[model samples]
Target: MENIISDATRRNWDRLSASTDGKLTSRANKQKSLKKIIPVEYLLDTAKIKLIEKICESYIGYSIPEIIYSIAVILLQSEGICERQSVQDILLDFQKENSIDLIQIDEAIPRFSHNEDFLGALYQSLLSEGDKNKNGSYYTPRKIVNDMLSEFDLREGQCFLDPCCGSGAFLMGVSTKDPSSLFGIEKDPIAVFIAKLNLILLYKDIDFIPQILCGDFLQDEVFFGKKSSFDYIATNPPWGNKTKIVSNLIDSKESFVHFFVKSYNLLKNRGKINFLFPESILNVKSHKVIREFIILNQDLNEIHQYSSSFTGVVTNFISMKFIKGIKTSVIKVRNKNEEFYVEYTAFQHTENKVFSLLKPQEEKIIEKVLSKSAYSLSSSEWALGIVTGNNKEKLKSSDGPNLEKIYTGKEIDKFRLREAKNYIHYDRDSFQQVARDEIYRAKEKLVYKFVSNKLMFAYDDTSSLFLNSANILIPNVPGMSTKTVLAFLNSSLYQFLYEKLFGELKVLKGNLMELPFPKIDSETNNTLTMLVEEIISEGKNNQKDIDEIIYNVYGL
Candidate 1:
């Protein structure tokens, strides 16, 4: 893990060095001079960042603590002679503790974006593998933050809140000159400390003090003292978190959605929200409620959907703007490519309220189809495959006489289930009951890949068990055969509907439940069944064959 991180850091540094030709840290560029002494950049894990926070938590101290305390004194509170002396002492102590022979504040000033950026950079430097998944800590890049702040347009008195403000990046990004009323809440105290410093540096020479504190916004009612109070709320809330049954905010299990709901509630009637959220919010099944809420209640302004917005973060995200009271009259969408940003107009409908990147006509066409009858996948009995806590220890490559064949999602394609690469101990004690083991024991059922870009399912009669990545569904629909259902799932139209309506890569059971399968006559079903048999027998995708029949049956 260390080596992987080291390599990633090395590659990033090389890219930076090659682009700037060492100008970023050349002696001629005194601010960048630190690069000469320490050639490579480092990242901090949550533990190390927390350690620094502890060292700096003291009221009056030297070294790291002094820098922390001085920032809090001069920036958070009022300016005074004692504060100035303390800051000077802190800097001197920091230099001495680091074993630096000399300190050149002017020359070193250019290396950092701001005094607060020093901590921001520190957090960026010490990351280890899987640290983000464990801690949910990822610093927002300055460029993105600056662009969002500039676009949001701060006012002298309008309030600004960054609900999950990390290192106070969004709070610091606010316009310091004509600063709005500042407020932020962070769950991580280390980040809260960093934010205090960053905001102080941002608001330097300005009189307004930022009110940034540490607390879980989801769990704490104290964070929102009054309803509909804030003017603007902005932040990239913590990703990969789960909510714990908060009132109106707990619309979904996902934590970011809770932040969105809470932030929306906190805003004044006409107040605007400028936030960064995963693109999945537009179409994920679990987030459907949130999407419905947005469509029904909120008004859109602009959405900036960026591909690979953050280099290491895997999920695509959007910078969204929404107004609380008005309907979205004109919506602009800007997509970020590797080298350029392209803009598109959001497909608007007079009556429907679907916010997606699809063109107007495409949305219109889909909306027209959706206006008809559709059934939920939940109408059927669907069960999740077994979640063996430790696959490596539990799974066997060579089957025993008693062992049962097991297939994972990777082994299942559109029409065929490949040979099981591993076998499971099907003994009564082996399979832990997650949903219902009896569902897997069904003699005939359809299994589909749980996490896939497109729907991929196959009819199974072997009563074989599968791992968690593959899920089983027994249809409850009266006439739709397993073959016909599989045909619809693999069809292009279904793919388009799933992608646009529910944008999650993971094909959840909820997404299936809401799908509208066109009712077909017995004759049409026979033809589809025949085609499905041919495709499965031949072990090929026969997508066009299935789609042509299905589309004609639907009279599209």
Candidate 2:
């Protein structure tokens, strides 16, 4: 069965690629030989487009003209074919029928040297472009595009725009819904052409070709002029620190912020903007302007949360819908489970409701606990800060004896601190000075100095502190140990509270400090502390054992 499917797929590719002369002869032969073959609809379905795109991408390369020719050739020979003809014969027939100059396609092919060069360059550019940054070193998965489209109600005649359209994936998805009204804006010239070709394949409208522009959305006067032009605007904006980009028109750190503010102006009154953005913008101190703009100007409706563990390539994205002049309900989903609904009243004011997939009765109990302890621990003096500058000078020249363990932003994975190779201890005066200046006193001292057998805690001034950025370590506290606090912080209960208060936004230092810690009895705290100690001790010898200990403790 697998072999049959494989053979069918191969035959489909050949049939799609066969020349006009070859196709006619093969179609006649197939008509004479076969009784009733499988329907094309059954064979291709929605997946056929992707398969053909991939196959052409694998063979014909990535130039816009080459891709168009390849697609044209493929579509012309939809019927079964047994033999192939020369490329010249195929090109001659295609040029005559489509009225496209064969010389233009031929010229584009050499610019790539061959088909392979073109495809490789196109793929690399799409993957490496500045706006393409979602998570570190990864592009947005196509599944996300399909899922968002499936979830939304996008019909014909409704205007659609992807402001930060990369290779026109979202626009393409929208075009599938309504080809007539779909439009996109891409800064990259190559991407713009690709998107244009992708659209032109299905819809041959000339006006649609000029819709995509190779200019910055933020600074481009052309975009600003089209105020309230679109009914729906969907985009996945860039994430992280380097998102601060220099605009061609303006020299400022806040260019992207300006771009977001301008987005409201572009939408019609009550027009919806469904965008995937970094959770940081919600609560990051530096991005307070964008946050305030959203709160004041638009109605933030729905929110879908993703985990930080899903960060490396596909970032922890929040899909938000913004409507003008309406109070919006915020829906938060964690781990593809645990949904929490909160109605945002006036700025910073929210009313909470619990949404549970299992044990509906549990919502009442969870709500009770949440209400009693709704605030963040950070609000109570627990601060948050980043470990930014590292001691590169102290790094051993060759393979010398390692001195001290160091921790960076990357080392702070999930919740707990992981051991890293690049590290330096507080030994030399110079090293101490660097450490004091860089790690300790760089921003505000969020690092907690462990008092003699007191609660081990750190201050996090940054917004992400609440969402497992800084870990609490308690020393000599009879009931509460460092591990105990870590376990509690990593709990579903804490996660629920985090989502309720922040909803796809970065968990700020103020928010983290305000979170109320459940008061466990001394005996239970001691038990949890001891258990944590044992787990950490075991973790040094066997990482698997440490995982097992965590699983057993969390009842995972």
Candidate 3:
């Protein structure tokens, strides 16, 4: 964790260190040193830069709280509130009570206008990426914080709390009439200290203590006296946190799920709870527990989808707002510039209670397609391609005496396969994961891309081996042949259904099993199969005919 500094943080620290030479121990020298530094882009950028540099060099081996205390003393001195002796007095009391060393900084600090959350930013920059991921603590951007805060209705004395708040981004963004109305709970002591400092800087003119505590929110029952104590709760909990939890309501070990359940338990009747989550929660099989809980218990008010918002993450994110104890039939969904309403019962009827935010016309098309279907691929045989654990050493690029052709996702297309570009020697003992011998050596099978936006299935009868990027499917439909199934899977109508119902980039088998396959007469099946063969023999010249026949057969 200590070796996972982000590139931006490293660059900022280096740039700041290169600008300073000797220690600036006097007020005159500190002010003069600041004037010689290069111009930066944002307010408080210089302060954050200097603070991070100091922490890395002087407090390298200290504990997190000890480092935080040093930062607090610097910030206090910069604000011209407390002298060095007063700071030492406060630290002596804290250390006497907690029995830990309170680090000292003798260097002179210059004053600056406290206009932003530079302390919070500095706290985030100092921590390594691995440490943040372990705690699921990525500070939310200020724009997103402000947007989520604007949706709430803050009366004069309404109570608001941000559970799992990191540096109090949401706490600082809320516009409550009274400063005391905001509360926060964080598990990291360093972040908790910075959060309290941020709120104090925000309301510097007032004289009140910030109610930010440091403890595990799930296990600590004494933080809130009773359930239903707050008017509103909003936060971006940790994602992909694999902490084990003991609960009768849900069996998921994901940290975000427990946070949601705990927050729901603490909300008052008719109170609102908003959360930002990864898009996979909508349809992933393992996450169905929380999805079912939401569908059966709470009423969803609105959902807004956003593109990738983090530095090194690629998954798209969405913000969902749920109201307690309110039952409604419709939910409002927004994506970019388009907005629409969907019946809440529509999700209830699905196999997994998936929240597929489709438009009204797309919903009608899906309903029309499923109504005429009588079969599915739930009974089919499925297998993943081989995982060699070391592909570079195991796979070969040229043909040899004992090597066989291996296909990847890049070699698969609609109704056909590109020329195989790699080969491998078959040995079950040398690989990490491989399907049964017969599944790969079947007389006929369908090979599809594992990670793709649209359906791309190819008919393969050559008994070829495939890499993990591709998967094997052998249909067991009652009356349809493998070719007929492949034609339906690669058709335009089915592609539309897959994209609308489950728009994930990865082609998961659970999602594939939920697709509908309508009953077709012998004549219709023969005609479709012939068109598929024509497209395979030629170069997709007869694809329109196959699409027309399938659409007409489904009565679309």
Candidate 4:
């Protein structure tokens, strides 16, 4: 056992160094060298396996041994030594050989190293499987986490926990600040071990055993037992429809709802929680439970929004810091140097709010706007938009032959809009007509559907509001042609309003109605309508002429 452990350790060290060297070389040479040294059948005996697991866990901090083993298996898999199934098979075989009187693999899976190796492997696997639609496991950039931590004045002795601790990045980060203060809970045993390994490697002096528990956080009794135990909780929870787990026991959405309630209960009064959540949670009807809970119980201190459309696969990520035992109101923070101030208004949608380092002049403008308008214009009308529900039906060519020309949000790239070459057209003319009409209505419940011969699009949901690269299409007065609305919404003045009001983040639906439009008379609106018709005519005849017309109208 000792010999095997020593040999395995030596081989692994050599492999690590060699892999590093391979990375510094050409792809072909790197592959050639990797193939020679890292073999598929490099087996470690029980003693070696236990030793390596302990070493990895100690190095990383607070993780399970099974997760360490899984990571090693994945690392081997990445080098083409073993497949996922093969790794699982080997682990099962190892367990059976020892009569299952060993470390619990189920518990260990969640404690995987939160280091680069575990994260990289998980990321690659997620990407390969296209798990975004299902799991919503987007990696939070470390810089953002550091920035968030710097904003708050955290002490060393304060207890910290990350409920949705993915690979324990946030917990590992906290350990860097003060290892003794950190604790975490993760459902993924592999991730828990990774996090544990990472913390052990970084914080050698800290002796407090990591308090990470592996289980469904929503259903787990462990999280519920401690009320207000943690001083700080930081996590970038999974976003969108991804990361949803379906089961016969409980619904995924319900689980999230429960988690939010539980989180509120867990934090002590005045305890702070810095969370990274999808912007949809702010205004989406489905998240009413969470929204109401925060509003009723916690004080919303700061909200920093990033441009959603610009963030590919990570749409509308907003960092929010909430404190318990404080008044339930929205406080806006511009920067670390400046203190947060409360802005009391019914229209203040915390989700649409953004923080920035403002100059004196910008601050004055903001003050003026806030003084006059107690609430955003869309406070009343900020309704959730229709869900396409299932795109497969609407994306099929056989259903609708001319559906290829329509556009969805995905087709809108940078400032340029691309026509969708593939789409589903509805056979029922009545259904198509209803969809088209609904797409244009003032309180339209359109499901991000593509419209034929229309370059403009309107969305009621706040999630779809912000324009990342350039201008986005918005609705004008009802019964008016889309061209007329497009001409004005796409104008430089409107663009300037968006820039001034929204900072870097995209303007959500709630902010859309508040956007001050150019005071054009009804007669001018008619004129603009006529101009757009002429441009459309010219576009059909000569695309270059249409471009020139658009340039002239927008003065771009």
Taking all chains together, each candidate's TM-score versus the true structure is 0.68, 0.50, 0.83, 0.49
Look at candidate 1 and tell me the lDDT of residue 102.
33
Q: Which candidate has the highest lDDT of all? A: 3
Model 2, C-alpha of 235: deviation from truth (Å): 1.7
Q: Model 2 over residues 1-68: C-alpha lDDT tens digits?
A: 22323334344435434332222223332212212112221223334434434543464445444455
Best by TM-score: 3
Which structure is stronger by lDDT: 1 or 2? 1
**Model 3: runs farther than 4 Å from truth?**
1-67, 77-115, 224-228, 312-314, 387-396, 400-403, 424-437
Candidate 3 lDDT tens digits, 1-556: 1243334434433443421121122333221222212112122355556655565567667765666666576777566554545344554554554566657765544443334565566566556544555567777766667667777767886888899988888888887757688889998866776777677666766656678778888777778454347888899898876466666546787778888888888788888888888888887767888888888884888887864344323256788888888887778888766788887655753577788777777778888888887999999999999999999998999999899999998999888999999999999999999999999999999999978988999988889999999999999776688888988898899888787777667788988898888888888878877887777787758777888888898777
Q: What would you estimate as the lDDT of candidate 2?
A: 0.44
Query: Which residue ranges in model 4 land beyond 4 Å of their true spot?
Result: 1-67, 70-133, 138-141, 151-157, 175-180, 206-208, 224-228, 241-261, 279-298, 305-316, 327-556
The C-alpha local distance difference test score for the whole of candidate 4 amounts to 0.46
lDDT of 1 by residue, 1-556 (tens): 2232344344544543422222223223222222211112222243433434343343122343334433444333343322444345544544455553331111112222452365654443433324444455667766677767775666666788888987777877776455436788888765676675565556555544457667988888786455337878888877775335456655577777788888888888888887788877765545667666765664866778764334334466788788888776556677644222111223222112235566565665566556554554567888888877888988999999788899999899777898889987876456565556678778778999877878888888887888888888988665777788878887888888877765666887866777776666898888888888888787666678788886676557
- Please give the ranking of all candidate structures by TM-score, highest first, separated by commas: 3, 1, 2, 4
Our tally of clashes for model 2 stands at 31
What is the overall TM-score of model 3 with all chains considered together?
Answer: 0.83
